[model samples]
Target: MKRLYQTVPTGCDWAVEAQGLVKTFGDHRAVDGVHLKVRTGTIYAVLGPNGAGKTTTIRMLTTLLRPDDGSARIFGYDVVKESHIVRQLIGVTGQYASVDESLSAIENLVIFSRLLGMGRKEARQRAEELLEEFSLTEAANRPLKNFSGGMRRRLDLAASLIAQPPLIFLDEPTTGLDPRTRNQMWETIRKLVNHGSTVLLTTQYLQEADELADRIAVIDRGKVVAEGTADELKASVGNSSLQLKIQHSYDMERARQIVEQVLKVRSNTSTETGRITAPMTEADRVTDLLIALREAGIHLAELSVQKPTLDEVFLTITGHGVKKDTAVDSSSAVEEVRV
Candidate 1:
């Protein structure tokens, strides 16, 4: 609840702040001392595998669930003590669409706007604009029951932005959408920030976090295993990634061993492609590696060095791949105190 910044930069304003937040459901400590600082008007992503407490952390910060320990402030307003004020400052869109099944798209948006205290005419106008912006004007009159998953997702986003609150919490906005539709959602999310709305989203898609977030926190088993920019997290894994394509398929294992010995790091070999990949702390080590490979009669067809990807960073930090599953914070058991 208090504005405290021991680790965050001094000059920036945080849209959401929480420190040592904890939550438990019987035996499982769902959220274990999670901490986050989202800068105003930036996209901050929480990336984690399933059941990693990403949703629990979001619920605590958004005042949907009470934390057993620590505290959080939304725009300097306490989520626990100043929940009413905090609610006014934010919007939340969960994974599932929260709209009336019998209502049309326009009707749903208008209803949401009106519920937020907008006049009927103003609500209708706002609904139309949102429908147009989300490219759902053609289906504005279609019933929600007939809408596709992507359409419903977009409408859900539009409903959440009816008031255009300062901060928005999106729990995997692009889940279950087609590639094209997912890209559209990404653009909309970017536009939200461009128009001065801060976004805090949780996603298991490593590429989504890498593409959308200004900063990312990787949570695993209810703990923040890593936090930083995509580049920073990647650098934490390795300074650069070295990739080698062997001239002979049978030589891949030998090449991998040579690479591991020369680079002094573990290397992965692809039997099919005759490729060897390893992390590199020094780029200059490539010369020695090439010499060693040549002496060992291992010829390289191609070679390259690049930064580590978010997938690699996830594997390195969490020791597992990302799992695509709905985050269960058990919010259904707790009566939602909607604002």
Candidate 2:
């Protein structure tokens, strides 16, 4: 309930801007030619699989790691040259909890507030407020080592926001949380943005990106492959998806041809279900498609037009699914950068 943020500066339209950012770990180029621009007061997501340089990009942006090449700025201040100012302007919550394992949740938050120069009484009040805000009040006295992963993660974020920096960086904040806890985290993230903090969060979950990001940048193999709003990215793949099942398996090939001819798009078929699938730029065209199928005597058992999902968009652009294993662990690569 207490005021957490200083007045957000009006000097820059972008909260974060980077061009051609690159970082290499010996032989591996963790981040290569990565570019991004995060508008002030919005949730921008860096969507990618593990080892896709999402964390590396975040580290460079947060001033925790230097780029091997390229340039970055936080709120118009050069990340390399004005890192101290940048540090004062942003908060970072890494993949793992960054608090001491032996300290109680309230104690850890109080320490964070005290370190930020809050008065003793103010620090205690602030810690108690954060404990309730993060739903950790019940465990406020429990040592962090006794807390659950979700609880620790919540506290980590609470600690990061002690000063309510203008910009916040969250690297896979919900990686291992249960569905309910993940939803809670999502709400908390939304609240941060609602209260005027620019949030840049890295996420592997397609639903998380779709649910939270005002804009999304899809990264793969250390490069940004796609960038746009959720709808824009989905539109990149297709408008809507058409799935049709022929009443007879013998009509499968005929139906596929009819679909392509009517929809003016290539279509694929599954031999097992005799189903025809194609991308539809115009859902209205389905009326003509159905007429064509009827004229051909291809009775359909089922049909539906579904919006393209982030999963489809990701796969279409990256040429693979979102679960690739990588050798780089950026969370462990650097000491936790709390600010």
**Residue-level lDDT tens digits of model 2 in 1-339:** 343445567878889888889999999999998878899999999998889999999989999899999999889899999998888799999987889999899999998888887888999999999999998999999988789999999999998899989999999999999999999999999999998899999998767888999988888889887777776665555666788988899988888888878877666578798777777778789999999888888899999877655455555566442222210122111111111
Candidate 1: the clashing residue pairs are none
What tens-digit string does per-residue lDDT give for candidate 1 at 137-253?
Answer: 999999999999999999999888888788899998888999999999999999989987889999987789889999888887787777777666655557567889999888887
Q: Best candidate, TM-score-wise?
A: 2
- lDDT for 46 (candidate 2): 92
Q: Where does candidate 2 have its weakest 10-residue lDDT segment?
A: 326-335
Tell me the lDDT of model 1 at 246. 92
Count of clashes, each model = 0, 0
Assess every candidate by TM-score: 0.78, 0.79
